[model samples]
Target: MALRIVSADERLSAAGAKTTMAIFGPSGVGKTSLLKSLPPAETLCIDLEAGMKSVQDWPGDSIPVRTFADALDIGCLVGGVNPSADPSGFFSEAHYQHLRESYPDLVQMIAGKRIIFVDSITDLTRQAMAWAKTRPEAFSDKTGKPDTRGAYGLLAREVIGLLKHLQHAQAKTVIFVGILERVTDEFNRTTWQPQMEGGKAGRELPGIVDQVITMSLFARDGDGWRHEPERGEDRRLVCRAGNPWGLPAKDRSGRLDVTEPPDLGALLSKINATRKG
Candidate 1:
């Protein structure tokens, strides 16, 4: 063991912050629909679970990452996949091993990209459960309780691995989308919850992303419904992140904020427009 040291302080760019976004909300909410309008050429969608083809109406080429390793292949980084009836996009274990073995190469490829999109990180949590099912010893330890060892461990590894990839990306921007599911709570009759709210892996995702958004479709109020100012709205959707929607909303110019349930498209358009001005 001779003397060898590596410098910790490394700065190679004059660019700004890295964008890692998470869109969270209940089912039937317009997470994917909103993001569909985004420039697919710049944003790469890694879809593990989907009902979005018809819903989002994405128009481009698709390269499937059935297993984790498949993601490591730069070829799978294909940009345009015209929407069809086929669903071959997802993450799997076989792909995971391939990714692990070819990690360095994938990291390099991701570094060169702008927006890296994970359709839903929720599938990875399920994948973690599947991964845990393989470990006999860990399974035996928590025989009755929730099995959180194997799959959860692997999920953590995968997420951390991707975050590590983002560090090398100069103009990096990442968006992770997960469906919103309702969970019954002691206080409310049935409250909305991010599908990833439970489990070991669920807890880790929010911290990694820059902002988390929750979108929902609400019933009309007044004669037919309760807990609202008025009624007759087609589908009442509120976008809440830091606080309650709290009145309609104000535009940047001190005007009216038009969109109801905010999605990637609205946000991106605003951001892009602001830059142009």
Candidate 2:
């Protein structure tokens, strides 16, 4: 086949299209609840951290991924079991090829959904690292530890690859839930970042997602410092959509408020409106 050239206008348009979002927050900060509030008919939740306990009453469909195998099952990538049965064997070349081939099926399953939520990526990375540690090639008996560099490298690649696949999938929205972690840089200033493992994934994830939001609480004076809110109460869940107070955030739509209600559906509407204008 001869090579063909196409103009920018011929390329796929991002405006008014599905968004890729990464939302991070402390435990019990309403991250899962906010996602559950989106249109249930068009949403599918992939629960990795048992986060559905709070939103158990939500009407949307949810798939609980207690193990990496469960995640693979959802993608229909569970090929023949490794004879050696090594936990890390799933990442072997043959198995990886199976995953690549079956990935389109997973995308097809999500094609009609407007939102595909993965809650949370932090746990997914943990599972990835744990799987890496089981690989003899990636761990050293002499050191009595996994090869930190190689293990995390594998994790970074696996995570980034899966996210990129979902990002380009037919789903209109893909949301990755994560936990918040505090770190101190050389400047001795404390900052918050997503609790995902591997330094590379931490640095790269924000760039891939259309929005990176940090969930927080908004309380009136004298309110106790509690992360969880009471049911039927008005304690607000705050979403910071941009860089502020050293929190990692970005909003490509340019319509999100510095702090707003933690309702993703409303935010998506605003983004669509802005893009149309």
Candidate 3:
């Protein structure tokens, strides 16, 4: 229960190279396609959906794919997937012990990354739900959002904490990908249309890291010249500064330059130099 420091100075210089983010949007918005654009060095992503295989020429194999249980399976990993009502968080102590016995090397391997991308946080959140189901039949809260002591919430907290810890201790850049959840709009004030929101965990992310980039899309830019483009009017990734589902970027200030061809090595170089400086 000790407080862990997450300063850029404290994090490994390798991991402190770039900002952490959450790329989120409605389905078919090309989230998977865009990640292929990032250079693995400046931005390595942990494949949760395993869709990295679809993209050719991306050295995605550089990033490791792991589940919350995968981390808990190893030692020195205190928090991650736990018991919950959702099927994903439904891990048991036996499963944890099994991971320790079976995949002991998982933590060491994961701890050695520059950028840690948790692709498709939707699945990650579901995994938390799974852990909730495994808790002993005690202190029930069907609300699905358990208190920190409750089963579901506890597991969710652990997973979130473990991720934050990875950022602080390992110095890996963290990117959590998820679908945007829509909530009633209270800010627009102009007709108050329904707005999009991130997953349940997104609500509390501001408390942990330095920055959270939300990759969101509004409307398809007329195929946007599938092959290439000549200007800002033709980018694919809808990126915002703080939260993916927060609001649309006003201009080119905080948007993903998806039009910037998918050159992994180049993007990574930029990220690393920034870290070195």
Candidate 4:
């Protein structure tokens, strides 16, 4: 086969580029409500946590993901198969083709949708771990007993594969929302991390997406801890790397400000406005 070269102009086309983002925030900070900021016609939410009450009035479509199987199916269906992966493995071309035959209606359900929204990764990780526990890898071969290490290892692979599958969708933006947890070390240093069952998925997630955002409530008093708006705090998204606070955030686009208003639609617009005409 001849060496097929794709020109830089073709590769950097604005229409061909899309954003993959991971937004983390503390619970009850209205993370799910960010969906409302996006165009209803272009957005599809994968409600993993069953926490759609926050955006009950948002007139957009959502698919309820109740199990790990549902997550894999939806991800493969929406994102398409990774041909480079093992053909026999899950989320591969074979698995995706089988899902297409099983779920014929999913195509029309997601028609014209450009943004794939996952409500929360925390619940998704839990579901993945629960399913992992049932697999043979989660049991010791000799003792036939439960193996936490094996289960977590499998869980990490499943979650990362699913996320990367979604991120591969062409000309479509994939946004994963996750719960952020505050941690205090022995040295009295406070740090934040994504709230997932296994540490691997959260730790590796930043490398999988173009952006890592931390959504939080900021007050005039310089404390971002209060969850109550009545207490004079407003929601903000930390979009830049190396913020003064120990928040996990990065912007690969090199366009966003240190803090942005909590709006998914606007955030995406800025990220995608890089290519020339």
Give the best candidate by TM-score: 4
Query: What lDDT is obtained when candidate 3 is compared to the true structure?
Result: 0.47
Residue 29 Cα positional deviation in candidate 1, in Å, after optimal superposition: 2.4
TM-score of each: 0.59, 0.74, 0.56, 0.92
Clashes (backbone N, CA, C under 3 Å), per candidate, total 16, 1, 26, 0
Question: Per-residue alpha-carbon lDDT of model 3 for 69-129, expressed as tens digits?
Answer: 5543431232333443244332444554555566566545554555566666676656555
Provide the lDDT at 41 for model 3. 46
Cα lDDT tens digits, model 1, 1-277, are 3576544322212122345566665555456565565666666666666545754457633334454444324322222221221244323334434554666565455444566667666664565445445655335453554555554565666555554344334465566667666566788766555675235445655565545555444454444422222222343333333334332112222211332434455564443342322
Off by over 4 Å in 4: 1-3, 14-17, 221-232, 275-277
Residue by residue across 37-123, what tens digits does model 4's lDDT show?
999988999999999998899999999989998898888888887877798987787988898788888876765788889988899
- Lowest summed lDDT across 10 adjacent residues in model 4 is found at 223-232
Q: Can you give the lDDT of residue 195 in candidate 4?
A: 94
Every candidate's lDDT: 0.48, 0.69, 0.47, 0.86
Which predicted model would earn the best lDDT? 4
- The alpha-carbon lDDT assigned to residue 96 of candidate 4 equals 81
- Give candidate 2 misplaced runs (Cα > 4 Å): 1-14, 72-109, 140-146, 184-188, 219-244, 274-277
lDDT of 3 at 3: 69
Estimate, for each residue in 157-197, the C-alpha lDDT of model 2 and write its tens digit.
76776666566654367888899877799999877778887
